[model samples]
Each structure stands twice: as structure tokens, then as C-alpha cells.
Target: MERLDGARGPRSPDRRGLPARGLRRGHPPAHRRERPGDHARDRGLGIALSPGFLSAFVFPSFRRLWIGAFLSSIGTWTQDVALSWLIHTRIGDPFYLGLRTFASELPLVTFMLVGGAQADRVDRRRILLVSQVFQMSMAGALGVLYGLERLGIGAILVIAFLTGLAQSQSAPTYQATLTSLVPHDHIPNAVALNSLQFNLSRAIGPVIAGLLLARVGTGACFAANVLSFVAVIVAIARIELPPVAALGRESLGQSLKAGIRHVVESPILSALTLLGATASLLAFPLITFLPVLAGDVLHTGAPGYSLLLTSLGVGAIAGAVTTAHRGSVPGRGKLMLLAFMACGAATVGAVLSGRQWLAMALLAAAGFSLTTAFSTLNSLVQEHAPNELRGRVLSIFGLAFRGGMPVGSLVAGGLVNAFGAPAVLAAFASALFLIAAAIRLRNARLRAL
Candidate 1:
């Protein structure tokens, strides 16, 4: 039988039409095995392409989905900027801004695991479609309310929370769905391209939001975001995904426990997840304290802050491109470790440098290292995870990544408030460097990934 993705079923045949051999004991499954030159693409003319960063686009499903996601992500970032601007201009309180951030992020910490469980149990395509519709509705509501001059802080907070809740469900399902869209060899390229699109959108979206806010106003930004969802919704509706097979009948608590246990039992997964959380806790807070660094240390004010953020986004895009070009290169595990160290070192250099130009340059390097380490870690996790448990595993990763940000920012904020941004940030960067060094020295298995 042909799969929904237009590929032959596993039981179909070998290239010569004979039955495929069954797996032998002590041998890894065919999907899990990696061979040298696996990422290379050979055309009929005998020309070979290495790394094959664009190979995932050979599949119509992945290509359509990627284009849709790219458009939607730009809109999402636009809405984010618009929302923050709306809250700041209207509420005029730092406390409310922080509250909005917290509301928008809390659901990832609380409900992402549940979403992961559902990904394993139900139809992911439907979940994505529903999530897109829900988020689009919320964005529309915000736009309409603001247009009518009836938007309240309470209304904004509630909508933000609901939208975040939907994200908690959709994010893991989206991650889990990538492997289904392409063959195993293309997973790394697909994953890297996914990161590339996100970082690209992250760079482009804010600039668009700034233009919209300056010329047309916040209402236009929100309205644009609502319309952007149509691309992703249409793409999701069109993709012919393989049906999800239920993994188990466990209760939510039990399902979560199983995922946690799987991670705990596997040292590689546990280490990778911990490293990600550590980066979030220590390295990423540099972004949170950037304004302080700009105003206090650099003395560049708002324009400086914008420049610094732009530099970081540029570096992240470069890093994503690098990962896509590398594909499934060996020593990615070691590369990730080095990236952690580089990220920490660059962040420290940026924090210590009083010169604005030097600081921006260092921050760009930090952003590049951070993105490289993250995309590499993500590729490694996807490679090692069994399909049966992939959704749950990825959810744990998402939880660590998303949950760490708020907590880290909160702690880093307090520390900065007490000790000042430069001092606190320097210490955090130092810790991140030491942690990566220690992991590199101790985790031999991880180095082999």
C-alpha cells in the first residue's frame, strides 16, 4: 500500500521487488541507522550535492507547510510587537507589561505535556487546524476591540492567556509532525529549515511591525496577523499526513510520567534537555536585560537597544543557515557543546565591553552560538527519539525551553536589580561557560551524537 505521503509502505518490497529483510536482534532499526553520505543527493546527471540543505523541499507537503509557516510566523511576531506597544502606550506601567509577558508564556509550562500526550493519541493535523483557527480568532478579537476603543487590559490578558494555551498544544504537535513530512535522511535538513524560517521571520516581522505601528498604527499590525493565519490554515488543510496510531491508553498523569521516565532513563536525552534549560536560565536572559545594558552601561538608549536586538536576530539567522548547510554532519553533539561555550564567552565579552560597537558585535556572536547550539540539540533529539515517544520527548524539551525563560528572567531581573545588569549578567555567562565545559568533559556519550 502507498502511504498518504505518496511513499511505498514499509512492507511493500525491496528495490528489486523482493520482500525486505526483517530486523535482526541487537541491530538498530533501519530508520535509526545513519550512514556516511546519507545527506548527499545524486541527480540523473551524476552531480552530487552534499549536506543537501534544500532536500526537504523535494517533498511537496513539506514545501507547502514551510511556506505557510514562514508567512504565519512573520505575522505572529508582528502581533507580538504590536501587543507590547499597545500595552506600554495604553497602560504605561512596567508591571502590566511584565504581567502580559507572564500570561502569554505560562501555559507552555503548565499544559505542554498534555499537548504532547494528545499528539501521541489523536490526529495532529486537526489539532494544528484548530489551533490556527483559535489563534486567528483571538487576534481578530483584539483587532476589533482596539478599533472600537473598547480594549481593556483585562481583555488583553485573557486573550493572551488563551492564545498561549493553544500554543502549548500546537507547538509539540508541529515538532512531531516534521518527521512525517519527509524521509528519515531528510529530518536534519527539515529541522534546520524549520529553524531557519523561524529566525528569518523573527528578523523580518519586527521591522514590518515597526513600519505598521509608525504609519498605520497597532490595529493594522493586529489585522495583518489575523489574515496571515490563512496561509498556514490552508497549508495544513491540504497536506496529506499519515494517520496517527494511538500509542497507549494511559491517563494524562501516567502519560506525562512515562515521558519523564523515558527522558530520565536515557542519559543523552536528559543531558540535552538539561543543557537547553541551562541555556535558557543563564545565557538567554541577556535578552531580557538588554534594555538595561543599553540605557545604563552602553548609554545608547532606545535606538541602541533596537540595534542590539537586530544584531542578535541577524546572528541567529546566520546560525540557522549554517546548521541547515551542515545537515547530519558527525560530531554535532560536540559542536553543540562548543556552541554553548562560545555563546557564554561571547555574552560575557558583550557584558564587559563598554564600547557600543564592540558590544553589538559580541552580541551578534552570542546569538549565533546560541542558535547553533539549540538547532543542533533539536536535531540530535529528533534523531535519537523513538517515533513512539517522539511527541512526549519533544514536549519535555519544549517545556524546558519555554518554562525556563520566565523563571530565568524573573531571577535574572531580581539579581540585576540588586547587583546591576553588568555584574549579574557576567556571572550568569560565566556559569553557562563552566556548565558547558563540565558537560563536555564528563559526557562522552553525548559527545558522540
Candidate 2:
């Protein structure tokens, strides 16, 4: 059955498709670093797990790390909103707007696999430290450039790409190590809590940026974000994790290949990847053109733009809470299906609505659906992947999560300039509905969850 001595043979697959060694103590996966407290948790030794969200926070280390991550995410959203507003208002070009989105996400597709392999082989904390430093520098540069009136679209894109590159390198490591700070039973709650922090920041950051954008300026938002990186770097240093056993490292290519092979063999994992990629490529690009939506349709100026983004964030937070509570529910695929249909309906309704308030309401619905679909997909990967392959699997998830947005954005950006945001959005929304239906019907694995 299960062994803790780090030696084992392949066991039979469970419903989750987790590898045999995954449940054992055989060769340590990238993320499994055994510690004293963990040994106790594993053996159910003198510990009681709390119900719902409270359980994840019982560990002092996880709570501190969550706080830091929340602060950093808020800063990131602040910078993102400020930068997009600056590009749209100053340059007034939809193509550049699309290019900006593309630059930021491109590295996620290209470098994330290597980053995943690195997480398995190297010190994850070091990776986070380096990435944070690069992001801090980039934010500082943006603020300086804006203050000096030297900021241009080209320079902005380059900075965005560099910061994105840094994020791509560090995210897999951070995600892989997430469960290390908590007991095995709390991983679901932990993941849900992590989503909550991000979505909360998503809502709050844009609202704060909106106020600053109209009053002080974009530079102020950028400056605030620059300071936020400090929290994450400090958190990483303060949290002491279990000692990771030393193991021989694999070459980057071989390591990546192994990860790819794992996904290829796993039916459920492949379905999850397709689910995210389709949503990203088709449904998400519409989100990038929010500036155009406000300016052209609503004519509500900066405040209207801000409110629309806030609605999305608010809805996302609701979705995260629902997911957190659904941890005990076994039907992930069924939930994702309902959410996808809702997302499609909401997108179409938002596009067609003539009034600003109605559009915002519809977008909130879309936001809720988006979180449900993606987060459920994410949880599937975490549950099914073994500890050693966790980073690589999550990296593939990250790749699917991020890769399609740029291609869609770039395409939509050009078409928006020619036809308009509404026409392009409507076209993609229709395509997304059809794609979801086809994929859902064909993949029994996705339907069954």
C-alpha cells in the first residue's frame, strides 16, 4: 500500500489518477519536504483539523505567508490597472493595448516548464527572492519614467515583458511549495484561501488605483506597488519549512520531458489543460479591452472603468468562497460545466446590454463563472498529481492558464480597431460557448470529474 521509507513500486490508480508512488514516501517529489509537524499530521498524531476556512490558518507560518502574498497581489493589480490606463489614454491605440497584454503573458507559455523543473530541483525561496527584486525594480522604473514624462509604449512593453519573465520563473516554485506549510488535509482549504486573497486584491487594488489615477496620477499607483514586493520577500525568509532531502538533479530538457510525458499519459490532466486553454484564448481576451468598453460604450470615464474591473473582482471573491465550501463535494467536473455555461451567458449578456449598470451586473456574473471553472480545474491537478511531479503538473496548468490570452488579445486588438469591441467580443463569446459544449460532450473524464 503506502511506504514512508522512500522506496516503492507503482500502485494501482485511484479515481483521482494520482500515481502509485504519490501516496507513498518513496523518492521525494519536488514539493514534499518531510518535517516533524508534518510527520505528526500524516500519522494523525494528536491533532484535530478544524472545519472550513479556519483549518488552513491554524499554522502560524501559512497565515504569515498568506498575508504577504495578499499584500503583494494587491500591489500587482494596482500596477496592472495603472499601466493599462496609461497606455490606453495616452497612446490611444488598441493594437498597443493588445501588445501590452501579449508581452506580459508570453513568458508564461515559454519559460514556465523550465521553472517547474527548477522548483523540483532547487531552492524555491531563492527563486522567489530574485523574482521579487526584478519586479520591484520594474515598478520603480515605471514610476520614475512617468514622473519624468519619459514613459512610452515601447519602454512600457519591455518592462512588462521583463517583469512577466520574472513572475513566470518564480510562480511554479511558489505554487509547488504551497502545501508544505500546512497539513495534508488542509490543501484544499489552502488553495481556496490563496484564491480568495488574489481575488480580494483584484477588487480592492483597482478601486484604489482608480482614485489615485484621477487625483494624484499613475506614478503614485506604481510607487505603492513597488513597495509591496517587500512583504513577499520578507515572508519567504521568515517561514521555516521542513528540510528537503538532497537528490541528484536532472538536466532541464530531460526533466521537462518527463513532466510532459506524465500529462500525456493522464487522461484527466489533459482535459484540464484543454479546459483552461480554451477559456483563456476565447473568453478572456474580452477582459483586456475594458478601457475601450468604458470609453466607447459607457462614456463614464475613469470611474466607470474602475467600477467595471471592481465588479469582476467582487464576483471572483464570491466564486472563491463558494469553491472553498465545495471542498467536500466530489463533482468538480459537474461544477465546472455549470460555471462555463454561466460564463458564456454572462459574456453575451454583458456585450449586448445597452446600459452601464446592466453591463456591470452581467460582468459580475461572468467573473463568478470564470473563477469557478478555473479554480476547479486547478484543484483537480493538485489532487491528482504526486508530490514530486506537482511542480511540473502545475507548471503545465500555469502554461494553459496563461498561454492563450496573448494570442487571443493580439488577434482581438487588431479586429477591435477595425470592427469595434462589441463585434469582436460577440464573435469570441459565441465561439467560446460552442467550444465548451464540444469539449464537455466528448470528454467523459471532464464530465465525471
Candidate 3:
């Protein structure tokens, strides 16, 4: 079978029957189109990249970015766990936990669109470079504060907010760049590989952070995260891209409106946004509250918290790797629906399970399902949107993806205090399952996708 770009029709495979090659100058990138037939469906789900799943990797720029992103992700996961543990042990309140999560995400909601607009208007590589520097400084500052034993919850929140703001600038640029690095035909492969890198880092970073926290302290993980940014910076410096031709500049307000209008007008984008938002709001809150569960319900210390995070990451890795290998699966809408249900089911199981290992296992299952579903959706969004609007389209995705998780975390943080973590999680998980089923039943077009 030949590889298919969800847009721009079927790609001609090379002598070895792999997608001919990745994006290069002289050859314009594939334009966007709505995939409405079985062939379109196959492009969405049945991406048949043979001669191995690493075909996109044949492109030097993408491979460099891929490796760089993977290293950077590992550092991020390490810092994330360490920070959560620090806040949990230091603040010792569920409200603070939620507050911390909110602080991290509030910046994304506020600045993501602006960032997306900037990505469209400027050199994405420069955006990444500046953001990486900003984030590295924040991480280093946190490490120093922690080492001095002077970091308060307020300071922690401040730094988290700052780092998230930098992320807002970087994420859309990075995401939009992936499209440029590979030809349209290999997009699904690129998206899956990126997810695979993320989950693999997620799987390992926490365990490493766990060990460091158990023995050395949080400072080590923070310092490691600082170096990780440098790795990505260097990678960006080394990879060369063609000079972007100037487009007619729009005012910031106009650019913002244009991006939002695109998403609002596209049914598939709107529907996917709805599902991702709901799931993030009701179901993904579990991630923000996992440390609380570790401490209150399981009575495990930092080690237990790390183990729990590692379990989820491990499951996510499995899911990402499977998707990367399979290339595609038919009926993506149904896959997302199933994945959403599985996440809720797993959360329910975790809520009921009293034992730590059992809870970890269930969380792992939930992670697997959630990652698989979202990665597919991510690919779809990347494929469906026109190249000109890629940054803006993905920014809308970033808003839904990062924006909802924090607000949910904030709410869950307070709700857990009132109703207990177990009860709060169970209630929301049930709600999520019902919502998913209802959408599946009502939206035939969603199913067709």
C-alpha cells in the first residue's frame, strides 16, 4: 500500500515503495483539502508507510527536530514531576496544587493566540530559540530557589506561569514547523513519532526524577531540565530551513480573528475541539491531581508519586509506539470515541482501586487510550488545515489541549478537598463517558471521519 496525505490526494511511492521523500525546496508542500471518501478515510486512518515507520526520519531536518524534541521532553517531564512533588510537600494543600496547575495554564489561554499569530508572522526557529532561553532561565531560577529552601508557593506559581507563557510562544511554532519538515504524505508518521518521543521521555524522566528526588533532591531534576533546553537550542541552530517568503502582514487583531474564524467555520475542527475540551475538562484533571491521590489515598511518598507518573508514561509510550507502527487504523472518529470511553473507564477503575499497584495499572491503561486518541486527532488537525493557517489551527488545538487541563485541575483540586479525590474523580469520569457516548450517537459526520 502507498502512503497517503490526508490532503492533496495519494502520494507516489518510490522504488522501495516508501513515500517518495520528505519536504524540500523547488517542490511546494501539499495544500489542504477535506478528505470525504474511503481513500480520504484511509489517509486519515490507514497510513501505509512501509520500508519501516521511520520513513519521515529520512529527512535530516525532521530527524534533528525529532531527536531534539525528545530530549527536551524528557527534561520537561523530569521538571514537571519534581515541581509537583515540591508543591505537594511544601504547600501541603489541595487548593495550592490546583492553584499551581491554574497558574501554569492561565498563561497559555491568555497568550497562545498571540503566540500563534506571531508564529505565522515571523521565523518559527527564532521563536523557538527565544522561548527556549526564557524557559531555561525559569527552570534554573526554580532550581536555585529550591536549593536555597526559599521557594514559596507564590514564587513557584510565578515561575510556572512564566514558563507556560514561553511555552505558548514556542508550541505553535514547533508544531507548525513539523509540517514543513516533512512532506504532507508523511504527516501521520511524523505526528506519531513526535508523540512516541514525548511518551518515551514521559516514561523515563519521572523515574529518573524519582531516583534523584529519593536520593539527591529536586534541584538535580531542575538542573537537568535546564541542560535539556540547551540541547534543543543547539539542534535548532544546526538545522537549516528555507527563507520564508513574505506575506501581506495583517494587524494582530485581524490575524487572531482570522485563525479563530477558520476553526469556528470548520465542522471537523469544531467537533474535535468540543470533544478534546470536554475530555480535558472532565477526564484529564486526573493528571493534575495524581500527586494528591498518591499522598492522601495511597499513602505513598515521592517514590509512589514518581511511580504513578511513570506508569502513566509507560502506558502512553506503548500507545504511541503502536500507532507509529500501525501507521493508521480505519475509522478514526470511532477510535477517538473508544479511546475517550477507555480513559473514563480506567479512571473509574483507578478511583475504585485502593491498592497502589492497581491504581497505577488502571492509570496506565487510561494514559494509553488517551494518548492514542489525541495523537490521531493531532494528526488530523495538522493534515486538514492549510499550510498558511497551520500555526493558527494548531494554536486553537493548543488552547483546547493545554487550556482545559489546568482549569479542570484547578476545579478538581478544590473538588477533591470538598468531596475527596476518589469521589471527585469517579463523578467526572462517569460524566465523561456519558458525554462521549452521546456525541458518538448524535454526530454521524464525526463517525464518518
Specify the highest-lDDT model's number.
Answer: 3
Task: Give the range of the ten consecutive residues with the poorest summed lDDT in model 3.
Answer: 1-10
Evaluated at residue 224, the lDDT of candidate 3 is: 88
With a 3 Å backbone cut-off (N, CA, C), the pairs that clash in candidate 1 are none
**Residue runs of model 3 more than 4 Å from their true location after superposition:** 1-52, 242-245
> Candidates' lDDT values, in order?
0.73, 0.73, 0.74
Q: Write the per-residue lDDT of candidate 3 for residues 371-439, one digit (tens) a residue.
A: 887778788788778877887888887788777778888888888888999899898899888988888
TM-score for every candidate vs. truth? 0.82, 0.87, 0.88
Listing every candidate in turn, what is its Cα RMSD in Å to the true structure after a full C-alpha superposition?
Answer: 8.0, 8.3, 7.7
Ranking by lDDT: 3, 2, 1
Task: Give the residue spans of candidate 1 off by over 4 A.
Answer: 1-51, 85-98, 148-153, 248-254, 289-304, 351-356, 419-422
TM-score of 3: 0.88
Q: What is the lDDT of residue 280 in candidate 1?
A: 75
lDDT of 2 by residue, 1-449 (tens): 00000000000101111212224334333123443344235423446544574466655456556777778777777887888888788888878888988987788678988888887787776777777777789989998988999999878989878877887777777777776666676677777777777778888989989988889988899898988878776776655444443446567788789889999899888878877777878877766888888878778777888888899888888888887777747777877877877788788888778678998998899888888776776667777777777778878877887788888899999999999988888888878777777777777778887
- Candidate 3's displacement at residue 175, Å, is 1.0
Put the candidates in TM-score order, highest first.
3, 2, 1
